[model samples]
Target chain A: MSETTILRTEQLKKSYEKGKYILNNFTFSIQKGEVVVIVGPSGCGKSTFLRCLNLLEPIDSGSIYLEEQLISAKDKNASKIREKIGMVFQSYDLFPHKTILDNLLLAPVKVQKRNKKEVEQEAEELNKKKIELDLEFRKEEFLSKTTIWWPETKGCNR
Target chain B: MRDMGISVLFQGNNFVRLLIGLLASLRIAAIAMALSVVFGVLVGMMMRSKHGWIRFLCRCYLEVVRIMPQLVLLFLVYFGAAKHLGIDMSGEVAAILVFTFWGAAEMGDLVRSSLISIPKHQYDSGYALGLTKWQVTVHIIIPQTVKRLLPSGVNLLTRMIKTTSLVVLIGVVEVVKVGKQIIDASRYTVPTSALWVYGAIFLLYFIICYPFSKLATSLERHRKEESV
Candidate 1:
């Protein structure tokens, strides 16, 4: 199936030191609406790959393309690139100072610059929808973006 | 029959005088602390600057404040600056300046450490939700940092209060200075007045600082419980 590739990487390499590559010559690609699971042993570069894809960690030698735009360049704005990708961390990184309702509306109202009233309304609807569906999903579902699942199946970390 | 130096406080208005002196100390500490907490947050934010030069400059400033004694700073601001540099500042003002500078450095370090204590994933989570860098810092990072900063910040305030005693050396006429005056006045009558006078001053300091120490502990415990 010739699906449109949403994310693509070519020869992605990450190293902690010289001649020691954690992610060595790793080539990966995922199409829009596609879900890919990466399984590996401890310290086998699985987390490194996800972090590199999200632009959290710099790649040593490789190129990353998000919808054909080169994101792994030296001059690319990391924060700007990161905005388009959602990463569910192994630990559900909830802002402890804010309430659950405020947490839901925070990014939409502040980051996206959407109307607070509108965003709150949307969040209210989403909260109701989740309840109606009776789906016991974790809070990570609200933190929408890239889907990187870990071992615990919810909040997995090493 | 009456206690040696303890009687001095009740002889006339010595106790009230000491209270007023304490208020003066607190007054300077309060103003300095308020300003330091403001500037300290800025300094702390700058400590995280991507530019090596900025971090180095902040580090130097922090080290300078940390290394030099507060008394030296007071002399520099009060005697040296006032005499040579032609800066007309009162003892109180000088004390405030010295304490503020020192407190800012201390609070700045506290802020930096608290900011660092936050897990990396908090920023990642914010960015992943399409938050800009500024938004991530303001919404995600800062709130958590504030929670972590509070306990230490309160402890800093208590230290600021205790350190205000040093202002007496620069002739600020604060609590310790008043204690000295009381001891000096009744030197012949209460030969051991220094012991009692200083003891009361110590009691006053303990009264003010103990609650803050408890508060810091409670805040830290509350944070630990919540974060877990």
Candidate 2:
């Protein structure tokens, strides 16, 4: 019930078939800027829980709220709600046809309808930061041959 | 040399008649291809519908089209349907309708297979990026689908162009029909003309289809290289 609560689920229940609930009476809440991880053994409802949260899987019972707004309502536009939430899978699911920069800019430009120039600039900045971070990591880890790595990272980093 | 049947090519207005017939065939194939692509993309998307009944219906259409020969489908549309419906349909219209129906099913299957071939993680990532299903489809899924479908789509188009000779069976004066007419006219005057006339028809078809087949192969090769 805290004012900072960004996501909340109340007695949510989900089941593929009759009688067996994969996610039964699960109630949880996350505060603003909080990083919440659901860790459990394989076959436990961890993935199902994330899928339900993203509205990829419909739940049998209960409700989910994002920013105190009822998002799991049947009539709610799931895609519009999804626009405010970003999920990253364990597997890097980048679009193979698109370049790394294009993969980063696609959602922002196409889905969010943000200005392509602005999104591209933001993506460029993010890419620079990533390269810088990688370069730093490489420098620290492999101090022997900085020259060999410079040419590879220079194209993007510079 | 003057008595040879190959003189049909040099015969007055006969060449023009063949050209007109070739144009007609091209027009039909072009119109059918455009309509087929539009309908095919829509039906293909529908085939992936979450509803069981909808998917079943699309599957049934796909199977029926695949199972029945194109010539039979042409007869059903031109002769059978027109007769039962009490409507008069022109040979050209019937040919277009038949080709469109056949092409749409082929294109739909292409779209469906290419869509399913896309990595599952791509959808997951699209959704995770806060994209709605529609957005994910438009921005992420469709672009990939189009890329994957292009080579096969080009190949389907060549197949359509080749199969369009069947339209001549229904009395549409396409290239093959014109060739037969030329041969019949010259049969007595130049008995050797049949070989040359039919050979010309073969060359015309080869000209139309060969480039497309090459394009499809190259596109497929490019796709393979990119995947690697």
TM-scores for every predicted model: 0.79, 0.86
Which residue pairs show backbone clashes in model 2?
A: A87-B128
Q: True contacts preserved, each candidate?
A: 0.73, 0.68
Residue-level lDDT tens digits of model 2 in B1-228: 468667887797887888789989988999999999999998898898999999999999999999999999988988986689977888889999999999998999899899899998788767766677787788888988988999999999998888889999889998889889988988888888888988888898899899999999999999989899
Candidate 1 regions off by >4 Å?
A1-3, A10-13, A18-28, A73-77, A115-158, B1-16, B46-67, B82-88, B182-200
lDDT (Cα, tens digit) per residue for candidate 1, span B52-155: 99999999999999899888898888999878999888999998988899999999999999888888778777776667788888878888888899999999
Global CA lDDT computed for model 1: 0.81
Candidate 1: lDDT of B53? 100
Once model 2 is optimally superposed onto the true structure by TM-score, how far is the C-alpha of residue A64 displaced, in angstroms? 2.4
Give stretches of model 2 more than 4 Å off: A135-158
Instruction: Give me candidate 2's TM-score against the actual structure.
Output: 0.86
The pairs that clash in candidate 1 are: A86-A145, A86-A146
